[model samples]
Target: MREAYHKELESISEALVEMANLVGSAMGRATGALLDTDLRLAESVIDTEGQVEELQRNLEEQAIAVLARQQPVATDLRVVVTSLRMSADLERCGVLAQHVAKLARRRHPQHAVPRDLRRTILEMGQLAQRLMAQAAEVLITQDVDAALQLERDDDRMDELHRMIFQHLMDERWHHGVETAVDVTLVGRYYERFADHAVSIARRVVYLVTGEHADDYLPDTPVIH
Candidate 1:
């Protein structure tokens, strides 16, 4: 029975990795669809979101079952609880990818990203893919350093997000309100996707160290 219980825990870990892989692929395809205005690819991403959702639902059920049956403690308990949180983050990442795809579909042949902002959007997409891939590695290896690196990656995404807004707010902006709105939404989707990846990485940090990342921060020096 002890061996079987360990296997179940291992299975949960495997499921989380699988979830990350699926969402990472979705984000890549969604980015392609957005850049090229490929409705078919966009639709494919939107459709695959159901798979991510299903995986999350099934993983949550499995985790809950382990908790109820095995009553895991210490590291074992952290594994189960953290897995649930990671699944939620992964699911949200999938949804954000779907949102990107939907925007592409809604815009259709016109392409959602304008010519001037195309490079920035492309970089954001690539950054998102890299972050998710790293997040998956962190989940599988529980490498705390790699997990901390993801936070830096997220900062890059945040910078790109700000760049998008700056362009939209430029005095010479001429993309029209509709294009501005689309760019705003797409930029936000990519930013949120990276945020989710960072959240998952933070959870992994907590899982491995038994302390939240915030716990390690130096206390603000008290002013006299």
Candidate 2:
């Protein structure tokens, strides 16, 4: 029975890794859509969000089954709960990416964002996608150290988010409030996506160490 339970747990882990890969792709596509104003890509992101949610639901049900049937011990219990929370965060990250895509649709044909600002957003998107990929890798390898590295790497995303805001604020001062709101919201979606990725990393820490840890500093000026 214990052996059977262990096999089930391993299956759950594999499922989670699969779900993470899909979520990471969603984030990547959303970012690409935002940068290139690719309406087709944006639509694809929006369409695939349902799939991400479905994967989350399946993971949650599997976790509940493990808890109910096997009654995992402390460590295994932690892994189950952490995975549940991480999947939820990852789902939200996908939603945030879709939100960015929605925004991309709104400003179609009229590129309100400056080319330099678009480049910055592209960098921010890359960082978010990288973090998502790292989170998945940590889960796959069970590498606590890689998870810690991902946690630390979130700081750079925060920095890029800040830069976006500073630029938007500067725009407000110079270009007036015309494009300020759009810029602010775009910066916010990227920052929040990073935040969710960080949350996944922290959950990874919890999964391996049975302790919760955060990667970013508080008091950073958020775009929202």
Candidate 3:
């Protein structure tokens, strides 16, 4: 009975890792769809969010069962509770990804990002993919340093976000208000996606060190 109880805890952790992977893929594909204006890809990413949410719900149910049936205490209790919280972060990541895809779908055929700023958006997307990958690794390895690196890397996402606004504010801007709004929303989605990814890493860091870490300061004024 004790062995089975530990196995259930391990399964919850495994499911969290899977959630990280799914959200990462969702954002990556959403980026592609946004850049290429591929409605099909955007639609697929939007569809996958439901599956990620399902995983979150399942993990939550499993965790609640452990709490009620096993009555875990100390480390075991922390593991169950932490898994539940991390699942929330993962769920938010999925929704953010879907928002990106929906933006791509809403502006199909015409690129959501202007040609001048597509490069910046692409960079942000790549950074998000890298961050999520590191987050997933941190989930499995519980490497505090890797988690810290994810926080540092998220700084790039912030920079890219500000760059989007800078382009919109420039005097030569001629993309008009509609496209500008789309670009603004896209930047925000990627920024928030990075935030949740870092949050997941911090969750792991807290789980491991029993304290929140990472305090790197930014030089530039971050956009929101």
Evaluate residue 76 in candidate 2 and report its C-alpha lDDT on the 0 to 100 scale. 89
Residue-level lDDT of model 1, residues 1-224, one tens digit each, is 99999999999999999999999999999999999999999999988858988999999999999999999998899889889989999999999999999999998989778999999999999999999999999988999878877886688899999999999999999989999999999999999999899999888888887778677323323222
> Which tens-of-lDDT digit does each residue in 36-99 have in candidate 3?
9999999999888689889999999999998998999987898789888889988998999999
lDDT, ranked from best to worst: 1, 3, 2
TM per candidate comes to 0.94, 0.87, 0.93
lDDT of 2 by residue, 1-224 (tens): 98999988888888777877787787788778777778888888888868878888999999999999999888889888888888888788778887888877777755646676887878888888888888778888877667667767877877888887777656355655766777787778778877777777777766666655643323223432
Question: What TM-score does model 2 achieve against the real structure?
Answer: 0.87
Stretches of candidate 2 exceeding 4 Å from the true structure: 171-178, 214-224
lDDT of each: 0.90, 0.77, 0.87
**Backbone clashes per model, in order?**
0, 0, 0
Which candidate achieves the best TM-score against the true structure? 1
C-alpha lDDT of residue 32 in model 1: 95
What residue runs in model 1 are displaced by over 4 Å at the alpha carbon? 217-224
